[model samples]
Target: MRLLAELRRRNVFRAGLAWLALGWLLIIVANLLFPLLGLPERAVRNLALALLALWPLVLWLSWRYELTAQGLRRDAGAGAANPVSRRTARRLDQLTVALVLMALALSGLRHFVLDRAEPRGEAATGRALPVGEAAVDSERPPAVPADPRSLAVLAFANLSPDPSNAYLAEGIAEEILNVLARIDGLRVASRTSSFALRAQSHSAREIGRQLGVAHVLDGSLRRQDDRVRVSVQLIDAATDQPLWSDSFDRELTDIFALQEEIAQAVADALAEPLGVQTVRVRRATDDLEAYSLYLRGRQLFTQRGASLEPARSLLEQSVQRDPQFAEAWAALAATLYVMPSYYPDAAQTSFEQADDASARALDLLPDLAEALAVRSRIAADAGRRDEARALLERALTLEPNNANSRMWLGLTHLEAGHVDAAAEAFAESHRLDPLSGIHVGWLGATELIHGELAGAREHLERGHALGWRGPASAWLLKLALHGSDAEETARRFQDWLRDDGRIPEAVRAVHHAVAPAITDPAQRPAALATLRQAVEQQPGYDWTTLMLFAGLTDAAIEEALRPKPASGQILLMMIWSPVDADFRAHPRFAEIAQRHGLPAYWAEHGAPDGCQWHGSPDPRLECGQ
Candidate 1:
């Protein structure tokens, strides 16, 4: 009776009780009468708004009313004795008031009651480990290795004797790899690695071990001209168990449809225990011939050089044959962008066509991964990393396994010195395709960014031994960090580049030792002379000429970094941006930016314009804007 009298006498207590009563009354009324309101949610909101208005009123009133050990004081100025003045009791009352109100609000929310069983995705079993797991595996799997978050599709062997039609078989395998990569929680290996493994006959265990993938895909392809045949078998490398397998037979025109069918099937088979959520849709290609041309264009796009002209011609034919072909249009746009980004000298007219084709592709399917990835590249090259990332994120969401998007995004991160992210994206690309020299090279470089010389050397060695070339990434990483230590640099240079799978020894020495460091006008000209001479003597253009060209602090490097180089051009000198920490503080980076037509802060992020190079201006080879 004493406590009840005290509570009633206190205005704060009285007000708290009144608010609680009012709040309950409002909720009960709303729940019972909400359906009558056109917007029940709004009705509830209005009630909440009304209640919110009471908080300040309480605070203001409470400030003027104070309770003491002997008295209750009101603003009226008469300090009259009324109740206890236990500060702890007052604090407990306030907390209790808040907790009760919060509990009431939470209990009323309908969605919070989750009675439905949560979806258990493929994470339960069929998940494949990422490719960069290979590097971690290089250190050996932990005592109990955890399952991987990604996977790579290695080389699917060619069963046919007609090597001329090798493209047909590999194309099917590539499509499957692309499909698996598209799933949200899955990472497919790079095309370079998958293609390189075509020559090898490694067991699933060995291949999986080397790739650091928990799962490995192995199969064979055969083609009878217009008729194509494919077989794909998915295996769990950790236990060497065959998870799923499928075979496809289709005419050249029906290849796209067939590829999708295989992809959908494999995804289903891999979904259960592994628990990945996926949505598969098969939209028919009205023009089968046009689709075939798109596939052919993709193959040529990889080879690049003078052949891209024919590729564009073929891609144009494909779109003309089927104007609604989103894949063909996307492929066309991708090839078209390669020129300015790679061969700025290529007729600029193709870019106009590519631009138009990309727009058309998006019109057909706004969420198309291929179209989005191509657009992202266009945005990135134009110095819009934010827009590019937004597009690439959508592309990744639509199709998680796009090598081009992954590489570009990874490179963008690398340029910003986000070494770990770059490594992760590259690792995913590698996980989806272990045999790719490109993925290995990028991974090696990412590791070297943090000066992980050993990791870089290991990946570089794997890349070189897999046919990436010495002056490729392996040679640069090993020699660049080794500095001008003549003996060590010479030994590494000789051991790796002395033959580069096969080239002249006397010619290779000059590039390995002297040509690399000579940046002076006199030395550069002489170095170029030797490189040009070496290119002439060699059957295939080696990495030496490319390396010399790469060292040039020229605007031309921006254009050179673009994919689809001239067939016989120097393979060593890939242009684009550099991630070297040394040049980060150099003043020349500004000049390089100005030369490439980049903004004042090209690589810097957070811009109002559409182009935001990873959202910031990099201090290296400019943003190539």
Candidate 2:
């Protein structure tokens, strides 16, 4: 009874409550402020931990000190009878009540107001309203229900004695997938997602659930001498039960016929349920060797990076063997078109070759969707925006389910500054090919530019995890530097760059030199010199992003203006995105836009999402800040 009375006299209970209330309020405020300020989650977590650690100190101080009119004074062991002690206790109670009420009100404000009003993910990043447009409701439409007729074609197992023939099995499965995709109502999971899941050894049920597919096709192929054997099973993904099974033994020369037979059988099995009417299997080439080479090249092409050169070589051989192969020609065109992005010196030659090849493919098969899409990309790089868009539209109309065409369309839209259209195209491409790291990475990059930080982070991390190392890495590093502790983020990126083997050695060196300037203004001079030297030594890599990250806006603009054979798609996207607001606001930006032909394109298409054209005495372009 004496101990309790003494503690009360010192107002320990009242002081402890007040301290806790104050700590709670601080935590709530930190939670609300940190993300808005672009601070990392770790900042909030550390704040909470620091408050916890301070609890004991606060309690000790409360016990040892007394609040008086004269200010905090050492406790003089006054009993409850002392008017000062009683008064202090009453004041502590009032403070605690006020803190609690404030915390409650803030919590309510966050839950009922902020949460409801704040934009999220796609809605936030999809598009910014045009200047002077009324602010409409930002709510997204309800999601469409998943198609029940969807199917995922898993990579076929290679049962051949020579495991090197694995590409044959994969090629066959992809051909079937392509054939099924052409069916009007049939939804087929893309090769990237299906094959990736197969590589991970996911079961039919899991693959179906993850891919939003109702059916799964699994198969194995064995090839010996001039003969081949294929066995396939179609499973009900929901129950993992075999819906259909088949086996075929045929001469290697009959491979196309076999593929057609298999595709027709699968389509027939699902025709009644899916309302699929026809399955048209188009043969790109009759030459077995050419087909084999094309398949191998395509496999390498999909891997990207270090494999691109080999893919190009193999694809070139495929075309030589079968000059009339429209599909192979289109694939070759795409390979050549992307070479400049990885090897800039080849830009002019590659673009010329790509244009010729795409034209050849179109000549061979005028309706080939792949040829149309690849040609569109070539046109987009050449500053023929309207032509590119027309080509993409035609390709999409012919093959509505073509993820590659969709991705190209998205890029075209982005280049035109049609953010909403680009976002829709990218989202649809992602839905059609969820496991494609490039698609996911591009979507995330778009989100980043649109200011959807959380969505960008989520998709970028996922893309990186799936082995996309291009723009995703740079964008993620940019996000990290934008965080509360930029130095720490830069250090971490430097550490990652040291170990990453995907980037070329020369490009990696430049990245290392410039990365420091992103966070440390003192390093800018040395970093800029190194970066400029790198631009000369390596003509293929994008140095503009590096300059932007380093806060050398003028340098970035100059680099962007330099004539390069590579499609300046990335540069255009970076400049138009909100991240480069300062770059766009520069007085010289109008000149850059005119040089890049954006002014003409905009004049025909109207001003871009956030930009406007001012005519008359002072002709200039203005973008929203």
Candidate 3:
């Protein structure tokens, strides 16, 4: 009891609490402030560690010292005059009160002042406003072209007794959306943008305004035993009125048919404005288990990362149960194609498997838009630019709002050096899928390569805000190196590497040694040599990509054209922005171009804008074989 009283008298407990609260506040401040200030994330972590290290020292100081009216002093020895004088205790009380008030003030300022005026940088200039908020500036955005047939399908509410069946509801909405997207002349919203608005408190009218659609579709789902119940409404965006509403209760076996029924009904109801007659949709599979598994796999595939293998497994099961499930095969193919980009070690087998699955999808449903899109990507990967473009055009004709096809088509255009066409395609994809970081990042990258610094920074910043790391970070690092301070560039490069995941320690060590400052021109040759050797020793997609960015395009091309380590990496590099003009003029370019039918494509479609030499079109070099 005496010890406790002594601690209180000395204000040790108060000081400890004050220190802890202050430390927490500092951490919160640092987290919010660092990125805006262009400081490394590591800086925030180091600050946290430093604060923790000071905790024991704070406690020790508190225990040994006492505040007095005279000044701060060491506590008196046991035999000395008692230090607990009335003046001293009063001063301690005053100090504690002051500290508490300061903490409260800081909290209030951070929450109220800093929160509202937070520096998100210039890229936030054109960001979409929150629901219900009017534009803050006088310059109104150009009015969206009103398309009465345009609609967005928000995620269905999971109202089942077991909320875990949320995946089923999402799958149902997605399937319906896919069906609607296939209707000619219908401007259906991309699933990414529509689903992202699901949890917002926005009214249908506000949502329509934001999505640039005339109608909004939302619904609820409930599942019990082998039965499912769904309630859906189609609302007019301008008036917030339900234009059509319905409910369905059916056996789980009939879910596929139910989706078809819903899609057809919606199409038929909007046929007047849509200018398209309702066509009966076909169920991809009749087996209930296979259909359910397919939906689950599709959902998982969107999540990417660790979800990929499980999605592949589920998709395999889905196809095994129903070989004629064209959508499942297409989805599986798409997943396989993208897997190698994330897991380079799986590059070889993944592409081959992707090709096989795509073939199966085309075999089952020759005109399936999704299947065609995947096939188009494979064709591009094989350097068949003409074939890829034709396939993508066909896919777009069938599903104009298909963002994936549009994005891939943009890449094909980029490969042909058609800068304007590439920009248009990328812009269209971004319009359809505004929330997709990848779409926005690519658009920004196109701008960056074209020397539109201001526009590039805006989109890049927006991309970074919307889950763009990895390649986007590398691009940002490149930008920093071009214009910003050395320290900022290094910090961004570190962040870029984090996204590459589990690079070999030896490679990292050698990279650090040879390229301590990658932006430095003098060190580039040595760094490229080191990176080339490292890539040879351990064939990695990232290192090869790094080499390409490091101005070692010759080495990268040689590595890519090798028979071993076959992956889509070569195709990806070929189509990326800032095309290697020198390499394109090389004799080897003619061999590859002829093999890919590039000359024929150019003959039919005209040479790309970038295929020029000596101020005239490079007929016998870039555009001609």
TM-score to true structure, per model: 0.56, 0.72, 0.71
- Residue-level lDDT of model 2, residues 1-625, one tens digit each, is 9878777888888877887899889988986775444344466678888888887888788779888899998886743345588788889899999999999999888666554443110011121111111122112322553466788997787767897888888888888888888877888888877777676555566677777788988877778888887777787877666687667888988888888899888988887777646655666678999999999998777766667899999999999999999899988988888777666666678889989999999999998888899888877766778788899999988888788789889887777677778888989888887767667877987887778889988888777666665566766776776576877678657745753443567587678768777788899998889988888987666677768878898888888877665643677765555656788777777777676566677788887777787754666777776
- The candidate maximizing TM-score is 2
What is the C-alpha lDDT profile of model 3 across 535-597, one tens digit per residue? Answer: 668755345455544556566567555556654534433333443444566555555555556
C-alpha lDDT of residue 157 in model 1: 50
Clashes of each: 41, 1, 0
What RMSD value applies to candidate 3? 19.7
Task: Rank the models by TM-score, top first.
Answer: 2, 3, 1
Model-by-model lDDT, in order? 0.55, 0.76, 0.71
Candidate number that wins on lDDT, 1 or 3: 3
Could you tell which candidate, 1 or 2, scores higher by TM-score? Answer: 2
| Residue-wise C-alpha lDDT for candidate 1, range 53-150, written one tens digit per residue | 88667745644666554554563422455334356356546766775776566545422321011010010111122222222223343344434644
What order do you get sorting by lDDT, best first? 2, 3, 1
